[model samples]
Target: MPDRNSAAHRAMAAAVARMPDPVSYQETALLETDLVAAFGTCRAVAVSSGTAAITTALAACGIGEGHEVLLPAVTVVMTVAAVAACGARPVFVDSAADGRGMDLNDLAAKTGPATRAVVAVHLAGRTDGIHDLAAYTRATGLRLIEDACQAQGTTSGGRQAGTIGDMGCFSLKDGKLLACGEGGYLLTDNTDLAARAAAYRTHWQSDAPDAPAGTHLGVNFRLAEPLAALARHHLTRFPEALAQRREQAAALHRAVDGTPGLEPITAAAGEEPNGYAALWRLTLPDPRAFAARLAQAGVPNSTGTHRLTAAHLHPACSRFASGDLPHARVTVDALLAVPFTEHDTDEAIHRRALTIRREAVRWTR
Candidate 1:
């Protein structure tokens, strides 16, 4: 068991070998359609990365300089950059105490006259009253953008994670269910939105080369044919990969039961994840201290995909977060992720992982 290869490492090697040469346009469409099909009633536009997907979606939605968007502080900086990249302002919202989803109470409090959209982050595959969050936008007349970069196959009430919003953005970075080392996609049911997004992917080239009006403020964010090919090869096997991940999450959840310093919240009722990122929202007395202990305890990994950059680290433009995001800060301080699914990860490695986490919980107290 000790000499066995990491399941993730092996899958990476195989996927690398499968990367297609001279990425194909036809294959690109196939991958895009498949992404949309999984989500139902939506069109998927595959892009270079989830960050690109979000930026393209935001831009196509007509958001621009001076526009404001509602987002959670508990996530990575890519979408924040996407929003900023499109010349919009990102208003950070604090997540709920449970650390599973956005804090709607905070979101309602933050909605303002200049708000253009509310971006619901399905953080760690945890949906925090996203339905209610979306409804709030419906009543307020603001657009809804779903950030599912970490949520590949998440479902809420028979609806896929990305399908439940006006537009959905996903990531296929090194660590995701739909991963091909690095890739991302945008999905939407709105035909016009899909058309706009598609145009943005290829440097805004309209079918007519001479038309100056073809691409409006677009960027070359297209996903490579080879990566899309990688996506095709793995998407076929995703169902099984997700199942394996879910099964492992169940085991880790059981093993950590009754641990106080570390609390692992389960999927909200009727919500199922594709097993991409298994989140542990921290409630430790001293999160930083606990994290250090956890690291020393041999916790194999960690993540900061959806979190705020230190004010000093952020671009001067981001220094002034358009909205308040206290809970966002809290979630960032406590979030933890573990490798959930890989082709042939040793079953024992899974147990060892659980044991390490349980020990960290003991140290938390």
Candidate 2:
């Protein structure tokens, strides 16, 4: 938390200082253009927040009453809530037994006649497991919605995570890469899908004077101009910043590798990560004590968010899931993310990390 404000952020602040009022800002258009240029489509539309991004995308896709939305059971409630808000059911798929994204087996099993869409969440910034999910969506004839909100720089093979799905939603939340306090975007290569989502965020406007009633039902999910400007500036620096995040994560891997009682997610060559630390989640017997110990050691770290149990944990669990699934439990066994503040390299921060892990290593030993 201490280093959340970093040199990269200060650089951005300086640039923002010279900017005009956010309401009339031009960065919104520029960032959208940059996003389109990088992703190869104008289907990219910015919105107010990640939840709004997911909900707007859901609304645009025509998912509502009587639909069953399949998503990771271990995800934040927002994914399920978005579906429920549309008067649909939220079915859950646990992470693969290997522990990455949603399990294909559950996805296959839960998808039925009422299943209209699947929200494929890319946990952390890694997307190695999404290819098969994409294939599943294709085979089932279900619409694929990639939740790459936590996966800004993630990809499968050479293709970026969002591009492979029928439509993808990304959040530029405070903890995300290229964050703009709270902002989001929906991406796709499909033109009709693009038009539908664009109209879903605003008060309904189309070039055609005879635009459908679809435009009239939108909420105020629009991104503010100031946020868009910062997002635009940050987008320009993302390619370079991404390289640094990879560097930071690698350093942590080296500093803490093979430490007793710790299980790090192994990175494969084909599955390059987005170079961030919303990962490094370890499994320990007593998570609370371990987290406390790490804090006492002066290592900057904390738990990753968006974890949930079966809706049984809440009265509404029955509404979205039959029971709590395995990964939700697997996720609780001491998941912690190393600090990835942009200003400092992992080299500058690794000693404290090693010291913390070495201390915690005893519990595993």
Candidate 3:
């Protein structure tokens, strides 16, 4: 639980005082402006949810029927649902063996005539092969959309995660970095696309009351005011929070460094990742048993709990999956998320890490 006397709480209280008008108010506009400044994007649009942000990104980029969008096989079902909502077919790409990125080889092999775009998800705020994917998308002229919902402040190659793609979507759900309880936003550098997304956020209502009808068909996905206030306050604390998480992550990494069957997951070279969660890969033969042992030892851990399930395995997305997903299947099975939070003390993190190492060694032995 968050402290009631914290800075974020004070900001929230101020927001509540200024509320009753969420849409056309100071907080909303201020949040939008602050986001654009923070992410170095040309524009920002607050929306109802992360899913809405993705859907808006798809629609704003002109992804529609008969088009194909390539996404990682191991992703949340929401990403697939966003594609389906746009009436575009999703082509499930395999994950890389290390679980930090999409398998570039599989991504290249899956490209075809109808492939209009690629949605690159930054799993747990850890970066992937952005430079390679950016080059690939440019050479092929395919639009790139980043699903950085779990990666609010992640960056790579001197650029932010959401800004690297043609459009980027973020989530502000309960457990997200910038928790607004339930809200999301989009980032983009393209002016025209930004206009489209802004229009879509408000049901395509004309900017000018005197103008003819709406310029494009749209949906009601506007982010309310109170949540924006909470997000804004959390945004202010992001720098400090991110730094703390990095320290915690480093501690966890050191804890498992000499462990026989546990290792910290990593991003690509030169990519500075924003710590979202502490994740590890198990080399032991029975990861399920390891997870159980950790739980029994009072250190709850899980494989495929946070986000390891493959989207292709879900019925909603099965229609789009084809061929073998060897890497995706393997990565999902091996990775485990160790519970971590920004508020956790150094003592707590070290204890949890020790539990992980001790249980892992016992299990493997």
> lDDT scores for all predictions?
0.70, 0.70, 0.79
Best-matching candidate per lDDT: 3
Which runs of model 1 end up more than 4 angstroms from their true locations?
A: 1-24, 207-215, 279-284, 301-318, 322-325, 343-358, 361-365
Query: What tens digits encode model 3's per-residue C-alpha lDDT throughout 161-188?
Result: 8899899999988867677899999999
Instruction: Rank candidates by TM-score, best first.
Output: 3, 2, 1
The residue pairs that clash in candidate 2, if any, are 245-275, 246-275, 311-317
Error at 332, model 1, angstroms:
3.3
Q: Which residue pairs collide, candidate 3?
A: none
lDDT of 1 by residue, 268-329 (tens): 88888765544565666666556555556555444332223422225653674654456555
On a 0 to 1 TM-score scale, where does candidate 2 land against the true structure? 0.83
Residues 1-365, candidate 2, lDDT per residue (tens digit)?
A: 22438987666545544443232236666777789887766468788887777887787788888998888766656666777887778887777666666777777877799999988776567675677878887888888888888778776688886888888889988867778888998888877777666666764443113345332466667798889988887888888878887887877777776776566776555777786663555657776467666766666554322223433344565654576686655664456656575767555676766676677767676
Q: Of 1 and 3, which scores higher on TM-score?
A: 3
**Error of model 2, residue 80, in angstroms:** 2.7
> Against the correct fold, how does model 3 do in TM-score?
0.86
